[model samples]
Target: MKKQYIFAVVVICLTLTAFLLTDSSDTIVKYPTGYRNWTHVKTLVLEKGHPLYEAFGGIHHIYANKIALEAYKSNKKFKDGSVIVFDLLEAVNSDNAIAEGSRKVVGVMEKDSKKFKDTGGWGFEGFNGDTKERIVKNMYGECFSCHLSQKNNDYVFSQYRK
Candidate 1:
């Protein structure tokens, strides 16, 4: 009887351990909803022959939620619940003028201080253009690494243009 009880306790502990591990991994960021209707921050074009042309050659539209916008405008760190979106679209030439084309990707950065403590309180994600499938499974190596260089600016690269 004692052996059986011990075995049961061991099983319970193992189950709890497994549950916690799975839950942490499942904390992968979710796509922010209704980000499209957020405030338009800026627009940029990465022209061909530019250094980042191959990776980000497109017409990029940046948006930010109210919280993020406030933080940007005030030059403060982005607060928790802040969200920013980078909408990338193809740039096509029509009548010798560049125009926006189909979307290429939708990149996002969500601020949750505790949940994303490993990445400067930011959760990064990239959604594919067509089906909105998430492409960036992790941000530590890819997104956060790049943004780390901008630590002086609160890990944000974009500035609010007056």
Candidate 2:
């Protein structure tokens, strides 16, 4: 009887764990629809030999929404609801000219002070290529670790361009 009771408790615990893991709550950051039409903040290209070449080696464009744009231009802390996007593409160097190739990934940063309180009121997500499929398995360790260094800049790396 004791063994059977322990088995039932284990099963209940497993079921609760599965439910929590699969909870479709607001913690999940959605793909930023209509982000292309947002304000374009800046652009950059990282080629071979650069320290960040392996992971971020490519052409990248940064975009900001209204809230983020104002904060970026004014040099103020990004408020809640601010969003920034990092659009990366392959760099094609041909005919002595550099051009944009296929898209590599689309990274997004969303701010929600109350909801995303753990990650400094920001949630990071990466979409594979042009698809909406999520690629980031570990949000804090993978993305937040780098952003954490830019704490003074409200956990953002890109600066305002003239």
Candidate 3:
């Protein structure tokens, strides 16, 4: 009877552990649909001479969904369902003009209070230009660490500019 009880408890614990792990992984953020059609927040150019140019050299266009825009405009902590997209493209120079070139990547930030509580209620992902392949595999180590510095701003780096 004692052996049977111990085996049952172990089995129950293992099942619970498996369920919790699966639930967490299932909460991984999915690619936002029609993000390109969202509101354009701003555009910036990271030239070759800039300090972060090596890692992020390009033309960056920031976009925010309705949910995110509201929070940004209100200057409040973003709530769940808020999403921000960072569209990065190469910078093409022609004569004396510089313009956006081919896309390089699309970095995304999604806010879900419960799903991403460990990362300040934000999930980070970087998809390749095509938006099909995810380039960022580790959110906590690669993305969250940097954004953690901006905890006061709700782990967000960009500010809504007009």
Candidate 4:
């Protein structure tokens, strides 16, 4: 009977170890401070019927002190300016590989006259070393749709349209 109990404990320990090892690789850490050459862009002016009127678009209403930080990295550059807007959410679960509610999304916008640009464009999905996988997807459908109309105005639709 004692041998059987020992065997079960060993098996459980091994299984847990395997799960922990496999889950760690999926975690990623992100921070806004990593971006270099930071600057403050003009606060956005949101008009009715704007495509970004949905929840994921974030809170609307225009004021100079809306608190958006913009910047370009040293090594990376574009003809106009590779604009990036980022927001850091409060961390939730710090210990687990899969943290719930600890993450951020960074939007990258590049100016283009001919092509429809990302108005609040491509998002860089980030997570802080958790089992939840960090994903960065191109928001071509959501962000690009609005910028297409702003072709005459440098493909940005918000108040800070280039």
Q: Estimate the TM-score of every prediction.
A: 0.83, 0.84, 0.83, 0.35
Rank list by TM-score:
2, 1, 3, 4
lDDT of 2 at 73: 95
For candidate 4, write residues 46-83 as lDDT tens digits: 23476743323332222111123131222222333343
In terms of TM-score, the best-performing candidate is 2
Give per-residue CA lDDT, model 2, range 106-154, as digits (tens).
9999999877788988988999999999998888998998899999989
* Residue 73, candidate 4: alpha-carbon lDDT: 21
After superposing candidate 4 on the true structure, give the runs of residues whose Cα lies further than 4 Å from its correct spot: 1-37, 44-53, 57-81, 86-104, 111-138, 159-162
Count of backbone collisions in candidate 3: 0
lDDT of 4 at 130: 29
Model 3: weakest 10-residue lDDT segment is 24-33
Cα deviation at 76, candidate 3, in Å, is 0.6
For all candidates, the clash counts are 0, 0, 0, 5
Model 1 bad stretches (over 4 Å): 1-26
Which stretches of candidate 2 lie above 4 Å from their native place? Answer: 1-25
TM-score of 4: 0.35
User: Which candidate wins on lDDT?
Assistant: 2
